[model samples]
Target chain A: MSAAGRTVRPVSIASFAQSQNVRKDNERNEAEGLQPVIAEVFANVGITKDDVDFICSGSTDYLIGGPFSFVMALDAVGVWPPRAESHVEMDGAWALYEAWVLFQEGEIDAALVYAFGRSSLGDLNEILTLQLDPYYEAPLWPDIVSLNALQARAMIDAGKATEADFAAIASRSRRDALSNPKAQVRHDVAPDVLLEDDYVVAPLRRHALPPITDGAAAIVLAAGDKALQWSERPVWITGFDHRMETHSLGARDLTVSPSTAKAAEVAGVADGNVDIAEIHAPFAHQELIIAEALGLDDSVAVNPSGGPLAANPLMSAGLIRIGEAASRIRAGQADRAVAHATSGPCLQQNLVCVLEGA
Target chain B: MAERCAVIGVGQTHHKAKREDVSIAGLVREAAKMALADADLTWSDIDAVVIGKAPDMFEGNMMPEIYLAPALGAVGKPMFRVHTAGSVGGSTAIVAAHLISSGIHKRVLTVAYEKQSDSDAMWALSVPQPFAAPLLAGAGGYFAPHIRAYMRRSGAPDHIGRMVAVKDRKNAMRNPYAHLHLADIDMKMVEESMMLWDPLRYLEACPSSDGAAAMVLAAEDAVSGHYPPAWVHGMAMRSEPTMFAGRDQINPQAGRDCSADVYAQAGVTDPRAQFDCAEVYVPFSWYEPMWLENLGFCGQGDGWKLTEAGATAFDGDIPWNASGGVLSSNPIGASGMLRFLEVAMQVRGQAGEHQVDGAKLALGQAYGGGSQFFSMWVVGSAKP
Candidate 1:
């Protein structure tokens, strides 16, 4: 009867697809932007929208300057005859979580998860400020850069990381992104050379910032036999969990991500040797914080798709991490991996998914 | 089903036009705290929290759940935000129930709210988009034509809308949580009221109120011993494209499919006979009959016959909105959850004066996004 003793239904990622990460694309609207990715993800798995029992999407309305923005995006999936559907305001990663939960119910056999964002359509930083505490923080209109700088300063003051460490992460990420064609920003700068760039904030250089991106991504999840039928190599989600810390920045220590640590523990992230990890850390220094919390070692290659720092689409960035990690396992590049997604300022809420090529 | 889930606690704030007394976090916490106390559980006993709201624009707050996680005691716990337009409240609770029904979490807290007074809902709904037509009529303006179409399709009398308004408004008098309590309400007053949208009088429309609703859902083994728990017999959510050539705006196919799925799971052959009382989302007066047909309580084009014959009144064979409904307290986001919470209350025999006598089963429903999104559930006193 105990929840901890209960076993979750085995679910696997069958197919993944994403739009080319870009600064802006004015020709296409949200639904138009998603139709190709949605169709390709299904076709890649030898199925169509009819094969999916449920559909879930992720997006924020503020980015589109309208409410119910996700409603229009539903058209991309061609849902008809009434299909079970839901949406999350956070990220496409959370939509995947919702779809996974439905799959676990054992009634639904498969689900389609997708996310789209046009960060270039609006003032990205100003719009993000609306995500802060409305009564206390939102009125201040503090941009995301300033808030992340405060977290970076806190990390430096705690002796957990420095500006050089931040530059090193950025240097490796962009360099790795050079191999990623879908990536928006790819370069070959050394850590020392990257550190020479002028600071966007006091402690963060231009390399520390993620490029504003407009993109869409979709993935299909199948249960048990359906998983094996859909793909030659299915990346099974062994464990999954997400946790949130207090909203107040002052309430947290800021040097470490306890929520990520808790989520990792619940998700059984350290159960076996990890071959590759894709962590959604938009800020350079935050990567160090999440990596430490997840207890990843140097042996684990992080952000081979260059992570969020390479191509950060507001809502799609997080799900892209899961897709990147799953694609590696599917392509016979890795046996085991962990994908992480963060929401709120300074990683206030964190989700961890442990996947294996079983 | 993966596992069994039940509704152990149901709580709602006193819905009103404006709740300036509490901050957004404080308002939701009020309902969450009550739900916890009702379940005889503390914040620590809850495993995860799921929150939903219509849109961030309703309160000028984006992703409010991230900031609300602390107030809902979600620190170091999984917290989810569900946004499905008007049906978000019901969808939020369904997501929380699925967490337990899937054997992932034991005790989950679900809450939904809208502080309409904090920001203008009309302005948010009518915001100018670059290449799209604005919903200039707002919600009522968009739906009034649908109501007119329903009347045209069914030949329903004009008195049906007025009858529903009087029944629900008077029913609000017995429920303290309802936002509206019209003591002198009557058919004459309703028919004479200001007509906002043609065929939809001011009295027939739902009020823009600020409120929140919460529920504590538990797995089979974690049910509270103090109070009778309402077992979640079945739940379903459905969505279709907002606009299409063959779409039926009057009785949406999504709502029909959603209700049929839930009813089939609950072994309901005839909803009119199976459910003792119902809490349907009736934001506009005509929606009462529109949804009665959509939910399959009666055949299409015949839903008004039930209303015309007083079959949906509190004393009728199949009572609807016994505790009033969205028409009484229209907190844009929480309206759906309120319908969900009321069914739980009715099934548990906890609804006070407005309670239906010997009510053992109930139907809860919500629809949103131009009637394209639907969330519905069945709750029973006996275990499924």
Candidate 2:
């Protein structure tokens, strides 16, 4: 396989906890908001910060309008005696991937992966616009909603999907989110009613847009014997891989996500029956593209936790996808699941994780 | 078990205060291309790409790797970004190494850089927060007190910092890519320089530069052997709270713990004698001696004595910063990688004029976030 893709040791998501999704957590700082979530994740598995061998976090400084925001967020973990730690500027899904890779080395048995973001702190549209090509696209200040709208229009023109399809996805997600106590935008609106909503940017309507959320999420991972020790029903990560596409919007066919397709294939998503899929689709129409790329059929229940549509917390949304999928498997709601995380404009990069319960 | 990983290629940009000629993508490409050429491989040979930088604010672009992915030939391949403060560059290399050492990938390309010229780094680093203490004085003002603390505790004369400033600048003269080529640097010149912070002259601090460093790491079996590989022996990272009650800021416990973890893996004891040389992150001149104690190269309070005795010079028993180190060329993010890369270069005998003769083993250390984050690695010429 191109001299890559060697076998990795089995790692399990022992526990997962997320902060209550909210529009703005004005009362608490990033670290303070994350403390309880970290406590929950640790307490879920009956462990503490001392039990984990390493700690890694995912976040972006741009959201906080400063540099090294992740540095201060380390307080939540209470690294008193010092700990082996690292951070990623991307999403928490990648942070988990890194920890999983280290697990393959047969070094430490457990690690903590977390991500925090306060999307409400700044103009998410302007902040996300800065993520584009500086010289070519970012200068134009095409907000995130407008960029996703461009992708939606391209899909509509290709006859791959329609405005009604986008609303249907959003309608199903928010309705499912009603059961999720932590979800920010839980509702029971129907597709027809959602279609009546005015478009935020042409093809994409207000219902299709994700709520601007400020939150954090954490997942405790254990490998080998520790995985079995952590949970009575451990959700084992069977396969994990991530891929990237070129940044040029004009060069890519917006109708499909080749990166997702490649990552899904590499992660062996089709190897078993995927009973549930937790896809991080910030934009409703993008969910269709990701589902198609994952090669899932109608039988596969999607967004059981409402996905990112109901509570998209920027950096943590993708990580929450994995947490949700693993939680479903651990709760005996599913036997097999697929979790996907996306970054960059129009999903230029994507990560896929396949989980199963023994 | 983990597979062995080795450095098969290394390349870096000619550091400057402002690389106005090239775009961010173009600047990174220069180092990536050179690393590929050195490895006798093409972009297609790389299984994945791992990049690191200080912060998106430094360049005014958020996560620039997404945009520069195509430029680094990361399309259709996995690309990752690391941001662990100033130690990010070393952490980036360690992550890339793990890809091979873990047997998940054969050959991976890692790059770390900082285009500080794009934005005012001083302003970006010290941006005001709502109710927190203002760090408007930038890193120098924040660290100057720590340096002063070292002086007060160690009972070392002020000239020790001036000697380090002179030593690294002279070493930079031998290294062509170094940003500061102070051929005339001496104790007198450093002593006469403007005092940016009390007890810290302008010459004693690192210069803000635009540069990038890259390396191509491969699994043991994947190496072509065209160039003598610098085998990675051990690598580690540790972190602690920035400010804690009774924390030893002078010689951080995290740094000592990190170095101990790495040394144990590398089967190293008596670091001063076990390693031939070391490249440490010393943004300010006094950090050279401060790190000596933290890294266990010498005893606490004796690090300045080692410096004064010429124990860390090129001709000394344990030379430090033979490639000018961070003091001569600080790209913030890339500075840590340069430390790791220089040791790899030394072991490969590819350091040219700045090469330490017959260097068989060496250490590379990087710290960030008020000396709370530490990343260190040991490399050897022989297969460990």
**Can you write out model 1's per-residue Cα lDDT over B1-384, one digit (the tens) per residue?**
678889998888989899999999989999999899899999999999999999899888989988898899999889999999999999999999999898888999999999999999998999988667889779999999999999999999899999999999999999999999999999999999999999999999999999999999999999993569999999999998987888987888899899889988899989999899999989999999999999999988999999989899999999999998988999899999999999999989889999999989899999998999999999999999
| TM-score of every prediction relative to native | 0.99, 0.99
Clashing pairs in 2: none
Error of 2 at B247 (Å): 1.1
What stretches of model 2 exceed 4 Å from their correct place? A1-5
C-alpha-based local distance difference test score of model 2: 0.93
* Alpha-carbon shift of residue B232 in model 2 (angstroms): 0.3
Docking level of model 2: high
For model 1, report DockQ. 0.87
* Top candidate, metric lDDT: 2
True contacts kept of each: 0.93, 0.88
Task: Estimate every model's Cα lDDT from 0 to 1.
Answer: 0.92, 0.93
DockQ per candidate, 2 decimals: 0.87, 0.86
**Candidate 2: tens digits of C-alpha lDDT, residues A15-65:** 999999999999998899999999999999999999999999999999999
